[model samples]
Target: MSELLAPALSGAAAGLGVAMPMGAMSVLLLQEAVRERRPAVAAAAGIAAVDLGYAALATALGPWVAAHVTPAEAWIRLAASAILLTIATRGLLPTRPAPPPTNASPGAGASAGPATELGTEPGPSAGAGPGPGPGSGANAGPSAGPSAGAGAGAGRTFARYVGLTAVNPTTALYFAALTTAQGAALRAGAAGAAFVTGVALASLLWQQALVALGALAGSRISPAARTWTFRLGYGLVAAYAVKIAFPLP
Candidate 1:
């Protein structure tokens, strides 16, 4: 039992060891969290969930999969490359236009002067414009519409995470090796379950920590800084995708 306990702890640690590295997924998640906080969190959760599933499968069926899935690795790499490229492209492109402002009520004070007057001194009657408030246009720029993209991005991120996990032959192989190495300790059913649980919990904890850190950083930065950071992050993501797609010797 003592021997079993030691191996179980080691196996859990091994799982975390494999996961804690800053891989493409980690970079993407951190960037997304900083750029779109809630969606990033959701995306991280999706990744962790998929990882748990992979770990379980690898633990339970490593030998069978190893024997039968010869070309699975290539497929996974291709899929991951494609997803990464798509995400990178989307990030590089200009953001969608801001949704049209809600029409101001006739008596409502919402109205903005012409674009030329935006930076100028406001006329006394500036409050009498067509929209809801004088500075409505100024406030409703692309930055204000993250909420619009947030939902869609969150869903896309979740799907992408799942796909990446499913197709990453390297991840599959890593789990297989990990589970096999620790299988003797995990032969005891309860110990194995505990080990797997610990790994899943650790992953969740770490990802949540990342999300919190990103949120804090986003909050502290100036809007201009945040915008630039977001652009830089996306650029890195694009570069990462390209690297994956065309690996160096």
Candidate 2:
């Protein structure tokens, strides 16, 4: 109610404070945006969704969260950290070449590309080209390429970010602190809603800004720079995994 205004500002500040830190999840989203701007945006959306979920829980259900969430927290963090390690390991390994692009356009016949003209196997550009078929327009994405498998992967990617954020004990602690930072205002039902809403909005805005920055940076970088950046991202992610997996006792 009238008490909501000040708490809302505090909530927004808290959301921004938590989200603005550059970390594994943040780097991954940025890297994805730089490498493939469109899909990266979807990943970023997933990040925002998790932020909103956590904010809502902290603001609206803070009174009950410790009882409900604390017991499973350790196991959840371990599982999430393991997943992050696997992803990091995969990134560090030399990437196997994707088989030459296939003409997956419906009913399209085999066509010769630069490779075929030289009596060599067709390369990435062969099947990746547009086909003169119905419904297989330019908007039809390449099959078996970086852009391929995005549909199923999108859900997994979203789930991964959400899981990582949710399992992080610190995220819950941060929210808990924020909940108690104020007194009657946050405890008031309607006033608490305003604070939660502010947190969600700030989180989403920060995430969008990050993705947009990555998208812009991706376009401007050379191939070599992108490669170096990719390696750096992997390294940072691996470091985070290690930290999470072996927390100081």
Give a tens-digit lDDT track for model 1, residues 33-93: 6554666677778777766776777778776666555455555566677777776666545
Lowest summed lDDT across 10 adjacent residues in model 1 is found at 127-136
Residue lDDT tens for model 2, 164-226: 666677677678667855655677777777877778778878887888998798678754466
Report residue 195 deviation for candidate 2 (angstroms): 0.7
Judged by TM-score, which candidate is best? 2
Q: At residue 230, what lDDT does model 2 achieve? A: 65
Clashes of each: 6, 0
How many Å off is the CA of 137 in candidate 2?
16
True-structure RMSD, every candidate: 8.7, 7.3
